[model samples]
Target: MSVQEWSADAATEIVRAHSGVRGALLPVLHALQERFGHLGPEATRLVAKELNLSRADVHGVVTFYSDFRTAPPGRTVIAVCRGEACQSCGSRELERHAQHSLGIGFGETTADGSVTLDQVFCLGNCALSPAVQIDGRLVGRVDADLFDRLVSDAAAR
Candidate 1:
């Protein structure tokens, strides 16, 4: 669903669905985000009230986790690995090329709403350093040419 279609009632239902469990905060947040694509202020407040926790508590958790998004994602998410292994293999240059090629930095989406660039600590492809993940699929041993082709393919999608 679109961000414009998110409702408090739906958010509340999600909270109620997970309220009977132990340590419901993370699950509830994940549920809300799954349903709405992102957790907005309304859902955060509702979750806080339902769980009897401060809004700050909920907000803090959301902000602290890179997986949680306060806004909607683009059509495709490209996560470039920035781990020690990847960095040692020219991931820094890859990152700079991505920023320049996409006109957006890590954690930001392109203006046309086709791609969102993110930085991941690792993708378990240390052997194939300088890895990148496109739409949840891992691509390793990436260079500038490969990165450009991936970005182009994602934008086309």
Candidate 2:
């Protein structure tokens, strides 16, 4: 979606409110991402202009942060943790299963656009290894069948 379609009032308010704060780029970008799903090129330009920074500077910040999304995410996000703890518990195998099942690899959406897959380092639930997050909810000990069920449930949502 075009950034012009975003809430200009909200964007203005966000920039105005945080313009004076040091290191405000991340928070501002996060707020915009939360509101609009991702930070498109237009939004980045607007932000840079409002903050008296260069577009390259804005792009640099966005690219530097993994949490900052540059495109719209699908309705459901299927993220699998790739950290050592999760990998030890078979996250790599699960990843392959998910990719094959969804017909998409990391940072991609399915053909029907029902879900977007991503690779995360850690879900912060190491004890519950082989972690998978469906729409922000942490799931653990996920096998192929179980992961398939989780994907189906998330798509249903």
Candidate 3:
């Protein structure tokens, strides 16, 4: 089935599944994103109506959390750590190299939808300083070369 059809059906099922729980908004949003890869307008509207919230309220919740995506992500996600520790260890240079190589800034996906670049404050690997998470696997001490390799590996996958 197409993503749109799946999104509509999944949104309805998720709203119904979580409607009875207290503070169901977050869970419902997470479920929708999990099933559909993102929360578009249709899912947001459905959640708002089911939970007695305004579209703005639902949209606010979705936007407030960095984990949520309003649109589908690329085939791979690259999250770079931007914490002070990582910054001190040359994360800035790595970030620049990544942007140049991918031709997209943070929070943007490649035109071909192969990769998405994202920034995270920390990956809890400060000891390694320049840390990056590619598809949820943490790699530390990432230099420009390492970053390139990681991106290449993700694309290959």
TM-score per candidate, chains pooled: 0.90, 0.92, 0.91
Please write out the lDDT profile of model 1 over residues 51-96, one tens digit for every residue.
9999999999999999999998898899999999999999999999
Predict model 3's lDDT versus the native.
0.88
Which sequence of candidate numbers ranks them by lDDT, best first? 1, 3, 2
Score candidate 2 by lDDT. 0.86
Candidate 2, poorest ten consecutive residues by summed lDDT:
1-10
The list of candidate 1 runs beyond 4 A from truth reads 1-4
What clash pairs does model 3 have?
A: none
- Residue lDDT tens for model 2, 42-157: 88988999988999999999999887888888788889899999988888898899899899999998777688999999999899889989887999888999998987787776
TM-score of 1: 0.90
- Cα lDDT tens digits for candidate 3, 96-143: 988999999999999999999999999999999899999879999999
Highest lDDT: which candidate? 1
Candidate 1 vs candidate 2: the lDDT winner is 1
